[model samples]
Target: FDLWADAPEEATGHQPQHLPAPKLALPGHEESYNPPDEYLPDEKERKTFERTEPSERKQHWLPEKFAALRHVPAYEHFVRERFERCLDLYLAPRARKNRINIDPDSLVPQLPDPKDLEPYPTRTAVVYRGHTSRIRSFALDPTGQWMASGSDDKTARLWEVATGRCLAVWQLDDVVEHVAWNPSRDLSLLSAAAGHKVFLINPKQLWDTERQLNTQNLLSTGFAQAAAIASDEIMACRWDKPSGEQSSQGILAVLVHQRDVKQIAWHRKGDYFATIQPEEADAPVLIHQLAKQQTQRPFRRTKGVIQRVSFHPTKPLFFVATQRYVRIYNLQKQALVKALQSNVKWISSLDVHPQGDNLLVGSYDKRVCWFDLDLSTRPYRTLRYHRQAVRGVAYHQRYPLFASCGDDGSVHVFHGMVYNDLLQNPLIVPLQILRGHKIEESLGVLACQFHPSQPWLVSAGADATLRLWC
Candidate 1:
């Protein structure tokens, strides 16, 4: 038996049980129970829907009793205003005050029209620094491979033009006054002037033998005698110096001048060259022939001191710059062709154009004058751009351009056109002003020349540097 005994149950099969319904509180309450009409009033009772006065509409929503608080105390308002004023004083937008008052047009000079000036040559491609003293003169080879420089340190150095590598260096007994490359295509040689001696050098022979020493394995046993002979030939004329040493030798010819040579100019054919000496100003210009290694007097005595001389590129004519005149002489006829009266007192340098129809003269008065040989003795255009006395002048052989360097430590390049027609005035446009070489103790650019066929320039400065600009 289970804990509890089951009572007898009545069985009502599948019948559902039902409960009584909920009763309403009151009869009227049930009728009024519509949720008090959702507690909504008429449209006039709603503040947002009611009409408002214009002044009331602008006022902030607050109790009317708080109007006195809205009108702040005068002293408190002044203190708050002062605080905001201080903040604004520090935070306001500032007006920029210019330190320099400049006129736009005066920043740079108004360049000439019709002829476009080239961009300035400010990019220095190479800085050659082998010269111990001021570089007095330098010349670019016709092939544009090497440049030869002469310095006051009594040395003449050959440099690979594109790389600025020193290939060979030769020492001299005195200051090297000038360095020039043989213009002849057949002869690969260089000429350097020191005191009264001019040395002609064959670069290939010197450089080729120099490169052979490293490859010969000279320390080996059997080839000792051959190496010894080669070594003697290398040192035959004292051609080379130890590394970092300055010495000179191995020259083709050394021509001695009677007096100190002030300037040297090569003939167009490269077979002959001329030298000017102060002591021989009254004498004819001395012409030296490379083939015979002989010096000859070609021109008769002129009136004034010879300042500079240049040979025409294509003609047999040569120009002589004197104190007050520039004279042109024909080598074949040995006669004066024209006398260009340079009204200036001192003509410092002169250069002949490649076309052989124009000449440029630079003077001590900071003036560069261009003369048309076919037009007149007077200058067609006189430009006064340099600040100091002109030191050197050069004309590009391939371009219609000319350059002038002065003691002011500036180089000015110009485009000068000699028109074929007489009615057209020659257009003279200033292209560039190159300034890099510093003026130290009154030294500046002493010499400058353009590459024969390329748009490049090489300048020798008194700062003992050679800068190449392209």
Candidate 2:
């Protein structure tokens, strides 16, 4: 897949020249230890001049002849300053709410989650305050009401969709790397990470393995890596797609190298699953599609190891956020789609909206982004909420809201809309900042979520704490 860069248009106005510039000066100041024609000291020169001044030395006034040099560079800095300030003064008033203020609270909003306290945004409440193994990650359902979290403790927990109260716990033998919920199923969840296996659990059917099996495999499984029960069809992954003559229970696992599986996730709504095999770079990792009946094609192997996959909630689109880039794909058409170049070194997290209009991704940059699907130019808004990598992101539909939690011990609530024509502000406007526990006092927030039908939110983290908000 290739990146889509903005097409260059014709020049806007007359071209400027590249001749050697004549030094800037006023009419009277011609030669001698002359002030720059621009006269004002640029920021750099002014800083140098100030840094050289002796603190203890007192300045003696020079005779009128030398008075010109006395003004010095800092004085020059005061004159020119930044040209943008003048442009700001001229432009701010004429701009719309999006341009006038970045934080949506300063101007207008289409829908604001009332739970968000504005101004200090007030950190008035403390939710679940305990957990161990450093809450490495967390996730909210596509519907936004329920929450799930994974920790280095080697376990994943399911919480009351609204209360942040632990409803049940599923244990993994290995340190959990990622967890996900099927966008179509509210009561079901999946946990997957580096152990070379995936788990599926249903709050209602946790005890009903056979009954759960009866549910549509799609109802049972999502694309694969973090295998959830998919639609009722026969679901299995075998390095070898079973031959028609051979009678084998639909294989349950895909064969890979001895131990190369790293991270994998399901498509938001489709049958396609994306995986990141354990190769560093330039190695080919397989990404395959499993069909319903026995056309029996071998699993497809493509170039490049898959790093991570995220699907559009309601569209036929899915994205692969990998070591090289973030690629959009049309699984049905089996064709490459849009690809976006991310400023972050490596993308650790990816989330899509129910409408497939916007995407949120977290990377090594310690920032979160809101990207408009229609506009491939760049991120509409970037959030500087964490000091380290952002491990997870979830956007609440029906409201201008989304939440992200990271290693920095904070969960940021973003409130803003995507602009199609002009990006005037950070699409993500931080509304509430939720802090995880200090290593000393309590626990941190590993993940956070919005309620599906109510105005509630929940979070989980390393402190072994789970918190709920309303």
Q: Best lDDT goes to which candidate?
A: 1
TM-score of each: 0.66, 0.58
Candidate 2 residues 218-277, lDDT tens each? Answer: 432433433332432123333332233211322233233224446555655424445455
Off by over 4 Å in 2: 1-131, 139-148, 162-167, 185-194, 203-264, 268-275, 278-305, 419-428, 439-446
Show the lowest summed lDDT stretch of 10 residues, model 1: 238-247
Q: Candidate 1's error at 438, in angstroms?
A: 0.9
Flag clash pairs in model 1: none
Every model: Cα RMSD to truth: 30.1, 15.6
Least lDDT summed over 10 consecutive residues: which range in candidate 2? 57-66
What is candidate 1's CA lDDT for residue 347? 93
Candidate 1 Cα outliers beyond 4 Å, as residue runs: 1-120, 205-248, 281-284
**lDDT by residue for model 1 (1-470), tens:** 45466643543344444433333234332122232443443455446534676345532221211134445333334565567567766576445455998899898755476235453344579999988799999998777878899999999898988888898788876899888877865556677878866666666533456322322222122123333333322221112211222213445455556566777788878778887875654443677655534456665577778888888888888888889899888989988899998778799888888878888889998898889887899998788999998888888877767889988988887777667787776677777788899886787898889888777788889999999887
Candidate 1 positional error at 251, Å: 0.8
User: lDDT of all the models against the reference?
Assistant: 0.72, 0.54
